[model samples]
Target: MTQWVFDLGNSRMKCAPLQEDGRLGDVRALGYGDDVAGALDGAIPAAVTGEAASAVLASVASPARTAAAVDWLTRRFGCISIVRTQPTLAGVRIAYADPARLGVDRFLALLAAHARGTRAWLVVGVGTAVTIDLLDAQGRHHGGRIAPSPRLMREALQQAAAQLPAHGGDYLEFAADTRDALASGCEGAALGLIERSLAQAEQRLGERPALLLHGGGAGELASHLDHAMLAPSLVLEGVALWARLGADG
Candidate 1:
């Protein structure tokens, strides 16, 4: 059976099928276009499916849009998708007091970490916002925090002050000049927030979690994070892990 998993982010929906070796088959990014379902349309992308796999999983960045995307995939792919929830999949047990409040992206990132590494893992997703979630040594979900990202800071400055150039999340080098200052201002804000959050969390938790970074801006964050592994297909990774385990039951 073909194993397929999809991750729908704000700007694009990404899919990764399972190869014979069990790694992600091929990575396909479908940008949001006319049809909300267009996020899944492409050259069969992987082995085209008449029916979705025995199981399917999805991680939607925006909670409000999750239902529509979930329905769209189930209709198009002919599979019932497991939306990350309080209990989540049968694989990882979430101990977060308020599991519903957990971001599906962060939750999935934690699962991805569990699949590949030891416990006491930290998953960082860098996008419109930055999320840092901790999975204890026993794989229990310890919850995490979210803060403004570089783009968020830039947008705030653009709104509050005039004459500041609006820059989206771009990997660019700025010399120590006015342009750099603005860039620094935006990135600095995000940096400061993450640094303090990580430091404090480590102190309180008493064990530093392995840092796993993912998202559109994951590359940009690797250089800044002391210990980070760039996980481009994290959402997909989580989806794949859940679906595989679900099919067993």
Candidate 2:
């Protein structure tokens, strides 16, 4: 039977089939709008729901939205596994005193990063909010930092000041126009944080950790950083790994 992984975030839901080779197949995404069920029904292919498949989900959406998604998946798949943040799993250990307090999405991303190799890593997620996580060469998490993403910054500014827009503009060292200035300032803030985190991680680990960027807004920031690996399907990859490890255990 086929196994599927779903990553439900604050803004969107991403799903993909876990292939026979233990890799993820094509990923599909749907944004959450007024009608959650309708969006899912319209975006997911009929073939996926028609067959006998199992599903694993890691959701950071609201309770109401998560309940709706669980209800829908329950009707479509024979088995459903919802991912939760664990203190220790598959070698990677969580640094949070309360494991449940750490977001599952962040945990899953750490899993995917640590699975890559023993090299130290700085896993960054740029979605609704920016998350920066540090993983040592031994898969030990060293806590993380969260900040508003550039998009969220713009949106918040737009809300507070009607003159600014929530989108558009380009990142520049010194923007001449208000739109470009807004983009530059917000994106520059995120970049500065990531760079600072990288330096701090290097100091703590005594070696430069490899940078891994993931999430919807990652592309915007990838070009600014050197040797940054952009893995948009990272969370889903972690879900697949989580499922595989569970099945093995």
Candidate 3:
């Protein structure tokens, strides 16, 4: 039977065919829209051919969107499972007092980072929000912080200040125009948070933590980070690992 793993975030849906050797193959990404449903319909069949298959999902979307997507997948794939944020998974313990309150994407990303056997990590996810979670050598979460991503910051400024444009211009050291100023300010805020977190992690842990950057906005922010490693598919990778464990059990 073919196994499929999906990561459904607020802005995008990513899915892949899980190979027998536990690697993802020909991953497909679709932005949120009516076309997403149609794309999945064709993509799944093409991935698995005519074999029996099941789908595993990790989602952080609204209830309406999740329900619609699950309903569609159930009709097409027959067996479907949705993974939740547990207190602990794959040896990584969540720092949240109420673990369920934590985003599963963050939890999954931590799992992926721990799986890499890194000494310690500062997993930074830059999407609708910038989330920084610290994981220690022993796979224990040391809490995290969340801030508005650069895109959200820009949008907020545009909404709150009529003079500011929501989209335009490159990030400049000192911008002369409204557009570049907005970009610089927003992006700088994100970078500042990450930089602060890195310092705090080192101070508290007594060693520097390796940075793992992921999510759609990571590329833009990564250019400013000296040691950040791009790990765009971490959540999806974690979803696949979760599926594997479930299959074994």
Candidate 4:
């Protein structure tokens, strides 16, 4: 049977084929719109829609959206596994006092990073929210922080002050116009948080951790970060590992 993994984030859903070697194949992302069911039906290949396939899901979306996805997948795949945040999984140990409170997406990202190697890592996810997580060399999570992403920040500003446009402009030290200022402020805030987190992680680990960037907004911040590696499918990669380990055990 073909195995698939789905990661449902706040804004979109990412799905990929899980190879026999426990790696991810081509990933497909579909944004959540008015007709999520229709979008899923159209995006998923017909061959993979039958009971012959299996699926694993890691979701950080609303319960309603998750339910909608689950309802659809139930009719398509034979078996489905929904991932939850565990205190410890594989070799990674989560730091959350209440593991269930931690977002599954962040937890999965940690899993993928630790599986890669025994190096301290700073995983930054730039999507609906900018999430920064630190993983030690021994696969121990050092907590994390979440803040409004640049896009969200802009939107919030626009909502609060109708004069501000929710999009456009460039990042500058000192923006000449309102559009540029909004972009600069929002991007600068996220950048500052990332930099601060990196410094704190370095101090706590006694060594600089490798920066791993992911999510839709990562591209905007990647150029500013030195030695940052982009791992767009980190969450899906973790889902594959989770499924593989589950099958093995």
The candidate that achieves the highest lDDT relative to the unseen native structure:
2
Q: Where is model 1 poorest over a 10-residue stretch in terms of lDDT?
A: 38-47
**TM-scores, each model vs. reference:** 0.82, 0.96, 0.94, 0.97
Top-TM-score structure, candidate number: 4
As for candidate 4, its clashing pairs are none
Candidate 2 at residue 87, lDDT? 91
Q: How much does each candidate deviate from the true structure in C-alpha RMSD?
A: 3.4, 1.4, 1.8, 1.2
TM-score preference between candidates 1 and 2, better one:
2
lDDT of 3: 0.87
Over the stretch 82-200, how does candidate 3's per-residue lDDT look in tens digits?
A: 88888877788898999989999999899899998958999999999999999999999999999999999888988998788988778888999888888998999999999999999
- Candidate lDDT values, in order: 0.69, 0.91, 0.87, 0.90
Q: What value does the lDDT take at residue 106 in candidate 3?
A: 94
User: Which has the better TM-score: candidate 2, or candidate 4?
Assistant: 4
User: Which ranges in model 2 have alpha carbons more than 4 Å from their true place?
Assistant: 247-249
Local accuracy of candidate 4 as per-residue lDDT tens digits, 122-177: 99999999999999999999999999999999999999999999999999999999
How many backbone collisions does model 4 have?
0
Candidate 1 per-residue lDDT, tens place, 205-225, comes to 796667788888777668876
Count of steric clashes across candidates, in order: 0, 0, 0, 0
lDDT of 4 at 110: 93
lDDT ranking, best first: 2, 4, 3, 1
